[model samples]
Every structure is written in C-alpha cells, then in structure tokens.
Target: MELMILLSLIGAVCSADITAFGQFMISRPIFCGPLFGYILGDIYTGLWLGLIVEMMWINAIPMGVSVPVDLTMMTILSVVWSCTAFQGCQEAAIFALALAIPFAYLYSEVDLGGRLFNTKIMHWIEKGIEQGKEYRITQGIFIGLFLFILRAGIAYFVFFIVGGIIFKQVYSFLPYEVVYGLKKAWYYLPVFGFGAVMYNFRNIKIPFLRK
Candidate 1:
C-alpha cells in the first residue's frame, strides 16, 4: 500500500508535467494512462482505458477558445486510482472511469485557474516591456507552467490520499444490488460516449460497409 500510494503521487506529478512543463499533447491518455498503469503493474487495463478514451473523445480538442474536457488528467487520475485499487478487476475499472468524470471537472477548474493566473502574468509582461525588461515571455511561460503543475500535483495528491480512504471504507459496505447497478451503468456509459462519437463521425463522413 505504501508503494501504491507513492507510485500514484509520483504519477500525478509526472502527469502535471505533461501540460504544465512539457508539450500539452502528451497529457493525452495515449501517454499518461500507460504510465499510471505501468506503475500499478496493470499496463493492459490502463492501455485499454486510454485507448477507449482517446477514440471516444477524438474530437474533443482544446481549440483557441473551446476548453473541452481535460482528458489527460482524467486518464491519469483514473488509471492511477483504478490500477492501485482495482488492479485488473473489471468492476473496479468501471467504477474508476465513472469517478473520473467528477475529477475531470475539478481539473477543468484548475486549468481555468491557471488561465486566470496567466492574465496576471500578461499584465506583468506588459509592465516588463514598458520597463525594458528582457525575456518576459519566457518568464511568463515558466510561471504558467509552475502554476499549472503546482495545482495539478496538489489536487491529485489530496484526492487520492483523502478520497482513497473514503472509497475503501464505503466500497466495503456496497451491497450486491448496488454493485449490480453500477455494473449495469458501467456497461451502458461507454455505449453512450462511444455512440456520440460515432454519430459525430458519421455526420461528418458517413462510415459504412460495402456489402
């Protein structure tokens, strides 16, 4: 359990680095999921979950103004939690995936905060230019990265530690009936998510079979 906790904490920091310091693209589940999975020793499940999310949200890009969802943090946290707690259990996978949505929303808030922080940096940049300060742009980038990484790392650390304890205690009392409901819901959520994606694709360029 100690190793499990340590691994999760480390993964969270690394995941933060994806968008916070490194290229934003690597934050995608394609990269981060396998990372959490590898740490938890359940690479297969992590990879599959990442793949599913990647395809389902292929169009959910962060355009100039559009925020979309923070799928990378979602993948990282979900994979870390699921891999640590559930291991290779399908039921746990479903639960983690469901839980990830709320965390994704939380991450969105964090990202928004980062953007707001950038506004302050922007003002500083303006001031720097007026005063003939060199390399304000680089300083701004570093500050942006720092704010993003700090928030993500701290948020993840708290959620996993505090949330993990509660999750274990609560799940211990989960009745079979409730578990069944979760299973049913789990089986269907992906269908809806994937269906929406497929619908979008078919609308843009109808996919078909030539029989």
Candidate 2:
C-alpha cells in the first residue's frame, strides 16, 4: 500500500515531463520501466520491458496538436503490476504489457481533457492580463501544473491498485496454451520491436548525410 503511493507520486512527477514541465526524456519508457523496476526490486524485468516498449513505440511522439499514448504510464503500470504480482515472470510481464497498452490509450484521452481545461486557464490568464493583474499568469501556471500532477497521481494510484488486482486474478486463470503463447511472445516481441524501429528509421532525412 505504501509502495503504491510512493510509486504513484513518482509516476506523477515523471509524467509531468511529458508536457507540463521539463521535456527531459525521463518520461520515456526506457527510463520509466527501469525506474519502476528498481523501486520494485526487479531491475532486469524493468530493463527488458522498458527496451521493448521503447522500441515498439519509438514513433509515438507528441507534436503539434497530436497527442500520443502515455508511454510513461504504460511502462510504469506494467513494471509495477508485473513485479508485484508475478516477479521475474516474463510471460506475466508480457501479459501486463498487453493490459497496459489500453490503459495508456485511455490515459491519453484523460491527458487531452487536461490540456483542454488548460485552455480555459489560458483564457483566464489572458483576461487577468487585460485587467492589469499580471500575477494571474504565474498563478495560472502553478494551478495548471498542480491540476496536471493531481490528475496523473490519481490515475496512477487507481490504475495501479485496480490493474494489479485484475492482473493477478486474470493471469491465474489463463489457460496453459495462452501462457505458453505469452512466453513465446516474451521472446518474439523484442524482435518485432527492433523490426518496427528499423522500419520507422528507413526514411530518415538527415541534413548533411545521405538517406
């Protein structure tokens, strides 16, 4: 219980890097996965899962008005669930990944809603500026950051608790064949990720280098 709270808080802060604050790559799955793993006492699973997610979603970048999947959430949830529920189980880790992807998409929508709300704050700040209340800009910025972290923390806490329970229950009932397949996928998914990454880089257009 205490661990969950700590992880949720850490996740919220790291998630802020996505857009709310520093654009450091700490939110990237490669970093997030291992971070959660280290906290949970299974660095190998964290490293492996992080690498797979990083490669698989290498192109999921947020640019302009396009919002990408919350990869940080995905990686954090997967690592937390897998390590807590079935530590060192590659198949279970993969299953957790399967579950985490949808949650990531769901959180993306939540993130979009948060950004939309920030637009209203933007208007409020603009209005205050016109009224000679320039301090509202700083206040609004802090408010936005608070709201963003609050939503992220709440989401991570709920999902961490709920998803951990679901993963344990569902994984225990999975058929032998399905488990076998997941184990197989545990090896193949990284290969697929590598292929996907290579494919994504195929059309790279460098300024001073040939394509």
Candidate 3:
C-alpha cells in the first residue's frame, strides 16, 4: 500500500508535468521509468524498459486537437507492474508493456475529458470574476491542477494494484517457450524501438546515420 501510494504520487507528478505545470519533458518515459524503477529498487529494469517504451512510442506526440496515448502513464504503470510483480523478468516487462498500451489509450480519453471539464471550470471562474471575485481565477487553476493530480494518482493506484495482480497470475501460468520468447523480446524490443526512432528521423541528416 505504501509503495502504491508513492508510485501514485509519482504518477500524478509525471502526468501533471506532461499537461499541467512544467512541460519540462521529465514526464517522458526515458526519465519517468527510471524514477519508478529507483523507487522500487530495480533501476536497471526501469531504465531499460523505459528506453524501449520511449522508442516504441517515439512518435506519439500530441498536437492541436489530437490526444495521443498517454505514454507517461504507460511508462509509470509498466514500471509499477513489472517491478512489483516480476522483477528482473523481461517477459514480465513485455507483458506489462502490452497491458500498459491499452491503459494508455484509456487514459487518453480520461485526459481529454479532464480538459473538457476544465473548460467548465474556466466558465465558473469567468462568472466569479463578473461577481468581483477575481481571486477565483487563481483558485480555479489550483483546483484544476489538483483534479489532474487526483485523477492520475487514483488511476495509477487502481491499475498498479489490480493490474499487477492480473499480471502475476497470468505470468505464473505461461509456458516456458513463450516466456523465453518474451525474455528474448526484452532485449530486442529496444532495438526495435531504436529502429522506430531512426525511422522517424530517416529524412533528417542525422550525421552518423546519413552515411
């Protein structure tokens, strides 16, 4: 429970960084994954998995009205599940990544809904200002941020606990060959991710890759 709470807090921070306060890119999987891994005493697992996810979704950038999958959530939840349920198991990391993808998509909807709801809050603040309560604007910002954090924290907590259990149960029953394949995937996935990243930059003159 304590670890879950800590991870939940981290999740909120990462989610907020992606959309709320500092768009410092710390919310990126390359950073967030290792943070979770460090917290769970499995930094290498976290670092490697984070790199893979980061590469795999290298192009999931959000533009104008388009909300891509919440890759931050994917990184956080993947680390939480992989570390807690099956530390040092690449197969588990792969499984966690698979599970994390759909959850990432689900959270994208939640993220969009939250942004929509913020519009209502904006209207409320406007009404308050009409009544001479200009302070409500500041209050509204705080409230919006709090809600963002609350939503992310709760979602991660539930997914960490429930999803972690499901992963553990399912992993325990997998056949050896399948497990070996996943383990192999653990190493190769990053290579694939690197390929994806390179593919994204294929048109650019990346000095080394240019030749």
Candidate 4:
C-alpha cells in the first residue's frame, strides 16, 4: 500500500513533467521505467521495459495542440504492476505492457480534458489582467499545477491498485499456451521495438540532407 502511494506520487510528478511543468526528459519511459523498477527492486525488468517502450514510441511526440499517449504512465504502470505482482516474470511484464498501452491512451484523453479546463483558468487570468489584478496570474498558475498533479496522482493510485489486482487474477487464469506465447513475446517485443525505432528514423527528414 505504501509502495503504491509512492509510485502514484512519482507518476504524478512525471506526468506533470510532460507539459504542465518541467519539459525535462524525466517523463520519458527510458528514464522512468528504470526508476520505477529500481524502486520496486527489479531494475532489470525496468530497464528492458523502458527500452522497449522508448523505442516503440520513438515518434510519439506532442506538437502544437496535439496530445500523444502518455508513455511515462504506460511504462511506469507496467513496471510497477509486473514487479509488484509477478516479480521478474517476463511474461507477466509483457501482459502488463499490453494492459498499460490502452490506459496510456485513456490518460491522454483525460489529459486533453484537463487542458480544456485549463483554458477556462487562462481566460480567468486574462480577465483579471485586463482589470488590473496581476495576482490572478500567479494564483492561476499554481491552481493549474495543483489540479494537474491531483488528477495524475488519483489516476495512478486507482490504476495501480485496481490494475495490480486485475493483472494478478487474470494472469493466473491464462492458459499454458498463452503464457508460452507471452514468454516468446518477451524476446520478440524488443526486436519489434527496434524495428519501430528504425522505421521512425527512416522517416526523419534531416534538414541539411533534404532534397
């Protein structure tokens, strides 16, 4: 329970790093995956999961008004769920990865909603500024930050608890064939991720090299 809370807090901070606060690469799966793994005492699992996720989503960038799936949340949740529930089980980690991907997209939607709400706060700050009240700007910034962290923290906490339970229960029921396939995927997924990375790089138009 305590570990869950700590992970949720970490998730909140990392989630906020996506755009709400620091644009530091701490939000990247490569960093957070190992961090979560180390915290849960499974650095190897964390490292592999992070590397796979980072490579797989190499091109998932947030540009302009677009919101990409939250990779940090996906990676961290997978690491936390797998490590806590199944520790060092590669098959379980892969299954957790499958589960976390959709949740990442869902969180993206939730993040979009939060951004929409932020517009209201922005307008409120604008109104205050026009009326000669400068203090609203600071208040609005803090409020926005607080709300962002709160939303992420709550989401992480719920998913950690609920998702962990679901992963343990469902994984126990998986057939031997399915488990075998997942174990196979444990090796193949990294290669798949490598292919994804190469594909993304292939599409990159180097400015000086562009025709």
Which candidate leads in lDDT?
2
Between candidates 2 and 3, the TM-score winner:
2
lDDT of each: 0.71, 0.93, 0.87, 0.91
lDDT: which is higher, 2 or 3? Answer: 2
- Give candidate 1's whole-model lDDT: 0.71
Q: Give each model's clash number.
A: 0, 0, 0, 0
After superposition, candidate 1 runs with Cα above 4 Å error: 1-24, 181-190, 204-211
For all predictions, the C-alpha RMSD in Å is 4.0, 1.8, 2.8, 1.9
Clashing residue pairs, backbone N/CA/C < 3 A, model 1: none
Candidate 1 has its poorest 10 consecutive residues by lDDT at 202-211
The alpha-carbon deviation from the true structure for residue 34 of candidate 4, after best TM-score superposition, in angstroms, is 0.4
Whole-model lDDT for model 3 versus the true structure? 0.87
TM-score, cand. 2 vs. native: 0.95
Clashing pairs in 3: none
Question: What is the C-alpha lDDT profile of model 3 across 33-105, one tens digit per residue?
Answer: 9988998889988898889988988887667877777889998888889888788877888888888888888
Q: Candidate 2, residues 27-124: lDDT per residue as tens digits?
A: 99999899899988999999999999999889887899989889999999999999998999999999999999898889889989999999999999
Q: For model 2, what is the C-alpha lDDT against the true structure?
A: 0.93
Best-to-worst TM-score order: 2, 4, 3, 1
TM-score of 3: 0.93
